[model samples]
Target: MYSRSIMAVSSWNDNGQKQFVHDPYELYRSDFFPGLGWMLARSTWDELSPKWPKAYWDDWLRLKENHKGRQFIRPEVCRTYNFGELGSSLGQFFRQYLEPIKLNDVQVDWKSKDLSYLQEDKYAQHFANIVAKAKPVSGVNVLQETNNIDGDVRIKYRDQSDFEYIAGQFGIFQEWKDGVPRTAYKGVVVFRYPSTRARRVFLVGPESLKLLRITDS
Candidate 1:
């Protein structure tokens, strides 16, 4: 649906294919493109709500009117724009504050047969103890060990999830080496989207080889 408030400009792509460009003065207001308008609208609302009083609604409308249709929407340029940051931030805010009311009424199955045996296992107790004692810093989630390569174990977390970390943050992994219990600081790596395959490489440190439990050929 074309908005009466905004102007649409049709242009040709690299293959000389005709495309309609929706130019909304605000990057967030352009609905001609998918998901762009929604992101901008939400972000702008969040940023403006606290500052703008109820009396400022007319001003908001005027701002939209003046900027609409004059802006250019270039599809090629849009590809380079970062939407992950906005999407992740909005998702986190919604999940924390506005999760569905139905979710509150749903009952959790605490006595499931799958988890019944976990209560009786000493190994589970040890694992739980380890988890309880482990303090997670901002970026580090889990530290695991692998023998596949010099920098095998990855420090996994979505950067856009309000959890921020540098590339070289050290994580300590507790595992068995030569039949002896050992703990070593392995390398850290962030997770990226579109490549959700297992064993995704993030960061490999020089010391990662020294911390390996098994020697790689």
Candidate 2:
């Protein structure tokens, strides 16, 4: 069993109550909170290492800098600050609003799991396994909003889903073209090896494209 703790603002009432969200920098969205019963239940309590908070803080700070109009915690949020100051402010905010949660005994996986696989052979084998067992991808679409008669307007597809993903599987359709899903392919050939293009940093779950190496050649 894995043990984890989340901070709640209030104590348990006569009504059944439980863990609360522990985000300090996040803007409260009333509309989003009411329907999170499914998501809250399924969240895995990872043995998320200590470095995660530092990594997250750096990313969060950078993201906040990109969008200055949305800072609700700091009054002089426009002013730039160091990591120490930001962290201090976060601690203060946490003390004000949150109470430490009590929980039943949980088994802790203290062994450090190294996620950074730097070896080339490991990566190659990983991709190979994914491609070997991947679901067949179908229904790719390419839409040209502006027509150019002079030359072929170069179009690129981002690594995203066209339709709702089912069981960690997605598709690049053949017949689903001209901005619509269709029944069958129109003279399309899929690939055996995964494309090196459209790369993204993967620190978590397996990428959808890695499994389905089927790209237009």
Candidate 3:
């Protein structure tokens, strides 16, 4: 549910509420923030892994122990990154990596920036320095996008036994890879669970859907 490991900055709203945004493309896509020029550097097992594992958590605990007094969440908006606390380097990142787009408000999880693509290059160490100073809490946000809305497309897991087709529910198509079948792409999920044949499910379809990924009480 989470995205790949990437360096990020904390951005804030006028009301003092804060959120972490790490995607350079998304930063440029919105109008409220600036962009920076930085490339992600990857050289770790967690970075390569599809999901964070126990080993990753173990390392994160060690990092937390090393910086016991350090505060990951800023008391106030960062001066250089305050628009809304969107950073000064936002423009640089936008120009370098994204198309002409405004850095807008977006969602991000900042719990794993300890060793993101921090090393930009050999000449400039400012970004690297900033990244080094930023110590995210030890954790991982499993969900990429949590917004749920009617008519929004999402991914859901289904089973082989049930073949019910509900209107308004966009059925996801999967193809076999290496003789194994799989979903074509990934996106947000309207249904809490998943289905084999995805359909554009309506909020009020005639039939009630029992999500597959539910926990039993």
Candidate 4:
């Protein structure tokens, strides 16, 4: 169960809207609340059970303070795939979004992995350095050079519109929740691109670096 707890928030679209997206195989930490196949400690359950929402418990959990300062391990590729094609939303996004998710097939020894770096304090610093060191690329034209780049790259987006435009180009998730994209860490979304290499692309918000101290003087 401990290893399974490391699973990503695969389904349960909160907005009830369709926005096609896809993910790759990688691991990162973020605040995206898990919808299904999640584990909870008995003690933690004791604390939250009293305040459980009568309806939309998942949306309630999306609130920051509810899971604030808590480190959640989510994978770039979802651990579980949702097969329900009919629901309240009437399968609106099923064909475009949910239907295409590639379930993780790699058997990883999660128990042996060092997850200490994923802790709040440690991950913040570690991720900040990664974003800072990433080669900066601007405009969709420049993105064509990624095939030749040697390391991780970062693309800065001025706003939600810009983010959607850039995300559309790379064919990744573009929806935002509370001003943050899915699988985001510190206002940046991480995903491996081109589907054939190990290099990752970081779609960073304008204020992300400042918030992460990557731009602090």
lDDT of each: 0.27, 0.22, 0.24, 0.65
- Model 4, span 1-217: residue lDDT tens: 2332332334332211112223333456765664655565666567678998899876666667666545356666666677788874346576656676666667777677777777555777888887888888875565686656878888888898998888778666677766567657667887666545656788888888888888623
Residue 175 error, candidate 3, Å:
3.7
RMSD in order of candidates = 21.7, 20.2, 19.0, 4.9
| TM-score of every candidate relative to the true structure | 0.18, 0.20, 0.16, 0.77
Q: Give the higher-lDDT candidate: 2 or 3.
A: 3
- How do the residues 1-217 of candidate 2 rate in per-residue lDDT, one tens digit apiece? 1111211111111101112212222111110111111121123213222223544332332232322211111110011122343453467433322222222133323245332231332433443343343333223322212111222122223322423231112122222222222110111112111112211111111233433343422
Give the per-residue lDDT digits (tens) of candidate 1, residues 1-217.
2223323322211111111112211112211222222222444456556756575342242243333422212221122222353554367543432221111122335344243222222223432332223233223333233222332233333332211233222221122222111111132222221122222233323343343332322
Show model 4 residue runs off by greater than 4 Å.
Answer: 1-26, 88-92, 140-150, 215-217
lDDT score for residue 66 of model 1: 31
In candidate 3, what residue range of length 10 has the lowest lDDT sum? 180-189
By descending TM-score, how would the candidates be arranged? 4, 2, 1, 3
Residue 200, candidate 2: C-alpha displacement in angstroms: 19
lDDT of 2 at 97: 23
User: Judged by TM-score, which candidate is best?
Assistant: 4
Please provide, for model 3 over 1-217, each residue's C-alpha lDDT reduced to its tens digit, 9 standing for 90 to 100.
1122222222321112122222222111011111122122254334434545565332342232322322111112212232322444367443432222224454335464343333222212432232223222111221222223222232233422221222112222121222111111111111221222221221211121221222211
Candidate 3 overall lDDT versus native:
0.24
For candidate 2, give the lDDT of residue 144.
19
